[model samples]
Target: MMKEEVLSVLVSNHFGVLTRVTNLFGRRGFNIKALSVGETENPAFSRITIITEGDEQTLNQIQKQLSKLEDVKKAVIIPDDLLISRELLLIKVSADAENRPQLDALISEYSAKIASQQSDCLTLELTAAPEVLNLFIEKMRSYGIMEMCRTGSAALALGTQTVYHDAK
Candidate 1:
């Protein structure tokens, strides 16, 4: 059965590294649902978070290919059973005097914070699992969403273990 996977890859922060990694996915015809890349706390490397959906064999192949890239220092596919994953979403919804109170109540019920407020719109920030975020988005659709942005899933393994290919 196909399942979603979140992978954390460490690579050299160099020109074309991002292109190379993305090209690998494109060449394999894998659909990337979301991707976030940023410099790590260490200056020498960068972290890339990729969310993709595929069966076990396809995911394994993608991991093997990613590991072969020269710029990649480590590529770890976080198994569903061992990972704690969450994403942050910022949503701007249309609101006026009529619906403001109802929207505020919905936001509170979802445990979302109002990041900004204007005369006609409200911006809410929510952090939760992807499924929860999707549900929240659906709920906001009735009120008319002006804009929305989501941070791709960021994940860490549970317990004391860390997935480091170099240490393996």
Candidate 2:
């Protein structure tokens, strides 16, 4: 059975590397649910956090293939329960003077903030674990979410272990 999986891949920050990795998944008919890539502490390398759903066998195959690639240093599944992860969401919701108080309450309850306000709508910015962010969006649905955008999760292993790469 396919289940949620998060892979932390350490790779050389070189051109066409991302395409190669994504092509591997495409060839196997796998869809990446979320992917976030950014520079690591060492500017020469980048960490790619990919979230997808696949069975153990498929995950193993992908990991093995990734490790064998030219610029890929290593690929390992970061256990969902054993990692620190965060996602960011920006949402613009319908609001007015009468609804401001209730919106304020939501902001307080979820530790979010009113990023901007317009004549009849307001925008909010929230960053948190997936579950908490989902809940906040659900609650805000009642007020009509006008626009929204979310970034793929950024995650790291829970302990001191870090994904290492060959930086030459």
Give the winner by TM-score: 1
Colliding residue pairs in candidate 2: none
How do all models score by TM-score? 0.92, 0.92
lDDT of each candidate versus the true structure: 0.88, 0.86
What is the C-alpha lDDT profile of model 2 across 28-142, one tens digit per residue?
8876988989888988788888988888888888888888888888888887678788988999999999988999999999999778989899999999987788899999999
Residue-wise lDDT of candidate 1 within 58-135, one digit each (tens)? 999888899999999888988788888889999999999999888988888889999999998999999998889999
Give the runs in model 1 whose Cα sits over 4 Å from its true position: 165-168
TM-score of 1: 0.92
lDDT of 1 at 40: 78
